[model samples]
Structure formats: structure tokens, C-alpha cells
Target: MSGIAKTPEPPYYAVIFASQRTEGDRGYGIMADKMVELAYQQEGFLGVESARDEGLGITVSYWESLEAIKNWKEHSAHKIAQDRGKAEWYAIFSLRVCKVERHSFFEM
Candidate 1:
């Protein structure tokens, strides 16, 4: 996306997905777009911010709770995307889920 996500007050959760992409798109772009759209329809979705350059990509998705995050992880379509990411899209990846106890923002 363009700007940083506008999130609510702290005490939510964040899923940090960091990856090094493989060569070529290989349907990854379409799937990624679909996943983001689907995420917006899921329960407890707060917001998401993503960026990619060269081979590296990082996406942080905000959620209302741990259970909400787990639900999204187990979502059938998302599971398919996960498998495809490992099998075709990413050269290497790391995912981290964390409790956001505090946050800050600035604008000009």
C-alpha cells in the first residue's frame, strides 16, 4: 500500500511477514492482492501495511486479538496462499506474531 496503516490504540496484535521473493511473479501478485482483500473481510482485522523492494518484502497486519490472528491463519484460502508462498513465491521468509502493548505515530 501507500501510506502507513491507521491503527487503533495499543493492546492489539501484529503479524509481521518478511520474505525474500523468488524470480518472476508466478501469480504471486494476484494472490497477494486477493489475500489482502480477503483479510479486510475477516473478523478482527484492524489494518495492514506492506512494502517490497528488490527481493525483500515486509507486511505487518494488525489484528484485534491472538484468537483472531489464529483464525486468519487457519482460514482455508489463506492456507492455500501460505502453501503457495513456501512452494513458489518466496526464497526465504519469516513470520512473527507479537502483542502490541504500545505504539506511536507522527505526520507532517
Candidate 2:
């Protein structure tokens, strides 16, 4: 996303995915875009922010609840992408789901 995600107040969720990419694109770009598009259509999806530098990437996707995060994990297309990531796109990855108790934002 272009800027930080605009999420609701406390009590929502964030799925933080941090990864070390493999050498080449290997279809990763297409799948990443598709996943973001699909995420915007899923129930309870809030917003997303992503960044990458060198071979490392971080994507934090906001959600209305833990169930919503779980549903996204089990989504058929996302599952396929996850498998492909393990096999070809990511050298290492970590996924953390956490409750967002509070937040702050600033703009100028």
C-alpha cells in the first residue's frame, strides 16, 4: 500500500509477515498482487501495509478478528500462494498474529 494502513480502534488484529526472498521473482510479483486484491475482498479485512528492502520484506495485514485472519490463512488461493512461497519465493519467513490493543497515527 502507498501509506500506512488505516485501521479501526483497539481490539482488532494484525497479521505480520516478515520474509527473506529467494533469488529471483519466480512469479512472486504476480502472486503478491493477486493476494492483496483477494485480501481486499475477504470478509473482515481492514487494511494492509507492505515494504521490502534488499531481500527482506514485511507485510502487515489488519483484520477485524482472529477468525478473519484464520480464514485468510485457509483461503484456497492464499494457501496455494503460501505453498509456492515456501517452495520458490521465500528463503525464510515468519508470521505473527497479534491483538492490537492501541495505536497512534500522524500525518502532515
**Candidate 1 structure quality by residue, lDDT tens digits, 38-77:** 9999999999999999978999999999999999999999
Best by lDDT: 1
lDDT of 2: 0.94
**For every model shown, what is its TM-score relative to the native structure?**
0.96, 0.97
The Cα local distance difference test for each model comes to 0.94, 0.94
Note the residue pairs that clash in candidate 1: none
Pairs of residues clashing in candidate 2: none
RMSD of each: 0.8, 0.7
lDDT of 2 at 12: 96
What TM-score does candidate 2 get on C-alpha atoms?
A: 0.97
